[model samples]
Target: MSMQTSIALGKQYLLDTYAQVPVVFAGGEGMYLIDEEGKKYLDFVGGIAVNALGYHDAGLSAAIAEVVEKGLLHCSNLYYNTQAIAAAKGLCTLAGMDRVFFCNSGAEANEAALKLARKFGHKSNPARTDIISMVHSFHGRTYGAITATGQDKYHVNFDPLPQGFSYAKFNNLESVKALVNEKTCAIIVEPIQGEGGIVPATVEFLQGLRELCDQKDILLIYDEVQCGMGRSGKPFAYQVYGVKPDILTTAKALAGGIPAGAMLTCEKANEIFKPGDHASTFGGNALAMAGVNEMVRRLNDPEFTDAVQQMGSYLREKLVQLAALYPTLCGEVRGMGLINGMVLTVSPRKVVDACFERGLLVASAGYDVLRFVPPLIVRQQDIDKALAIVEQALASLL
Candidate 1:
């Protein structure tokens, strides 16, 4: 009947993978979630950057309602649905790509990208199936994604991972260049490294990769799982870098809060996946598309995206000022658009716990950086309210 009772039941059923907080949400409205006791918390973390439009948005709610009213949830990937088709079209058109493949999550999308790359290369050389991923990049927890992800924390326990995966240094073009050879199928990167401490790829580095990929005749993949769909104040972070990838994977904010993932690629690369090369039983279903379409439409609007850009700047400025107040504990802030990080000179988990206690939600990246990937719909004042809590939390750290 109570939140604690419900959480206890959940732990018994769910895997003990996540170190969850003690609060539970009964319902949520724009950037705020109410616990069963009716206590409200400012949701700056935005469901770990998945709620691009925040919780229970009217547009998203209406879309889901309308679709459910039509008696279609799991339409499968057999009969085509307009909702999915429209979403795929809108996504490709916005990203300047030719085709789109829908899945379920960011990790799934990245997994799809990996398969696409391998298949494309295997078709051409059959031997050149190797991939080069950057160190510290968080692709996903799936077998292929985990293999591609360069972090040891996720790699430990999952031994004998898929071969043909190697790591290079982040933001260092030379590191990537040194790894590329005849067997390299593609080089995957996140334009702005989201889970890797909110580090943005240098413009020169991205451009250099583009050129290198072109010269080597290898596919270039951009994993915009955390930095896409107006989160970066741009449709995609690749736009900011002026570099285009042969394959682009997106997911986190695709359906606002709904589970959806997409892999977009240019025309030449799109042919790699044949009729039965890949398929997800639940991919591109009508219900999921309803949510994805609404989110994409709303976020693609200039007014909404412009607001995200403006608010991101506003939030970053406040963080910079706050960081100045705590020189010893807080380091410089980094990142682009709303997906910024507060570089902490101390432990990130302590600050995160402190924020949670103060009725604010924040997430940590790597180990020492605090990330803020709030909903694009969040206003400047709500950000200020969240920042106030952040300031207080840092002050208490002293």
Candidate 2:
């Protein structure tokens, strides 16, 4: 089918929610996506950092296929399943959390975390119901998740958002301190603000929050939906700073592109829910758990995670070199592991469009930042090729 025809069909049937580009991807091979016209484009976006194992991972594919052949895709939450139990154990062990509640998306994972915190707060005292999130943070698009988002632009036209949620400046302890009170139930933050221009929190800032939460008896939640699952050179982004959270949420690459998410809670916060508290019908199905099992096994490997750090360093060095070459356009390079962004003087949308036209797939974050979140399995040669395309696209702007 023609790309235009596909786009027109989408416009006719789908909700007018996303500002989609005109491209009909037919298939993906490793790090490249083939369009309907048989043109190959290097996939740096990795489905917005969801494809952790790259395209057509042999082990992951085999596991999913085996589950399919077994004719046990989903058996409902009525009975126990081995896949969910194993997946939960693996994730909890890696996160150092006591238990997990599975869901279908990052937004759902965050929503669960929010509800868990509220329940925990009320259990302690009926008046503790407020939550403090950080400014410029991007939680999901659901009602609760959107309200938790700190950006006002998302809150537009969606007034009457869930109340008792407030915002504070990221990486600033004083801002968080000013917002905390006896009624505050929890503070949710992204260790690395993925959508907020790839800003990372300082070690001291995270440590201070831990201390404050401990002193005030407030729950500290880390929304690692975009930065977790080995993307930050570790099992969880909180591990990068040697700070843990009372509740941790993760998705995106949690199941190697499968639709799955999880909210993990430490021992103190694990008992907030009972059997009838919350549930998801399609959460932790056999198919998703199969993918999660294989993906976690690979992600848990030391060599695979080390490669992510090494590749990220190489990519950062190349970005720095590009910044030196075009000091007028490139302002700053920030991020850890495989998630990085280049601050630009020009419009990021124009650069992203240019790269797309040149057979490179990248994304724009915030207003003036071009983000690169290549698959964790991306190699040195892929980085070189991507850098070349980025250089060409960036030079065109000048």
Candidate 3:
């Protein structure tokens, strides 16, 4: 279908939630998307960091095709599936955690994590249900997850949010300390706040939280849904900080765009959930687990992960240069690994729109930051091209 036709159909039927750009993607090659009009645009957004290995992945495609041919798409939780078992083992090994509970998305993974936390809390005391989340942290859109999110904008019109969620200032140990008490069972944080403008937490802050959580017997939940899966150039962002959390929630890029999420817990919090406490209907189905197996294999490789770190440094350096060249238009650049953001003095949407017009796809993180979460497999030339397109887009604003 033509781009205009597809867009018209979408406007007629789809919800009016997103202010979508005027383009319809037909297919994707490595690191770029081909629009219905046959325009090649660099895919720096990576479908909001879902396409970790980029488009046209042979291994992932082969695995899915194999599963399709078997005609065993789902067997429910009643029967055992080899793919699910293997995926869980691989994820646990990579995460250095004891067990994993699979789900469909980041929000569901987080919801499972919260339930695990509350279950663990109630095991000791009935009233220990409070959860402390960072001030700007973006968890998810589910009732419990949205209630746990720190931003008030998402809370609007969703009145009577679930009780027992308090907000603490990001990177402020004092703010966290003030909100803590006997009722606080868990403290959820993003090692690097993704939607909150790609902000990274300070080392001292994370270490302090570790110490405080230990003292208070609180579970430290790192929402790695955005920064994990080799996006941070490390296996997980918490590893970069040399600290670990009691529980971790991850989803984006987990199954290479196959819609999978996992909530992993260390030994301390691993066995909190009984069979009847929590479960997902199609969480670890064979098809999704097939994708997970392939994706985890690629991301767990040392050479590939090292390249991600190197490329992240290269991308950050180029962004720093761009900021220096256009100080009036840009602000500070933040983030680690491939999930970086360029702060803008102007509205991020304006800059994103300009870049889209110039054959590049980017996204906005918070209110004024342009987020760049290219595929982990993006090459140096792709980075150079994306940088050039961004520079041209910024120059157009002048």
Give the alpha carbon lDDT tens digit for every residue of 1-398 in model 3. Answer: 67788999999999999888888888998898998888899999998989998999898899999999999889999888989999999999998888999999999999999999999899999999999999889999999999999999999998999999999999999999999999999999999999989999999999999999999999999999999998999888998899999999999999998999999999779788887899999999899999999988997789999999999999999999999999999999989999999999999988899999889999999999999999999889999999999999999998
- The per-prediction tally of clashing pairs is 0, 0, 0
| Estimated TM-score for each candidate | 0.98, 0.99, 0.99
TM-score of 3: 0.99
- The clash tally of candidate 3 reads 0
lDDT of 1 at 301: 85
Cα lDDT over the full model 1: 0.89
Give Cα-based local distance difference scores for all models. Answer: 0.89, 0.93, 0.93
**What TM-score does structure 1 among the candidates reach?**
0.98
Better of 1 and 2 by lDDT: 2
**Which residue runs of candidate 1 sit more than 4 Å off their true CA positions?**
none
Task: Write model 1 residue lDDT over 369-391, tens digit each, in one string.
Answer: 99998888889889889999988
Name the lDDT value of residue 108 in candidate 3. 98
lDDT string for model 2 (1-398, tens) is 68889879989999998898889888988999898889999999999989988898899999899889989999988877889999999989988899999989999999999999999999989899999999999999999999999999999999889989999999999999999999999999999999989999999999999999999999999999999999998878899899999999999999998999999999778899999899999888989999889978997799999999999999999999998999889989999999999999999888889999999999999998999999899999999999999999989988
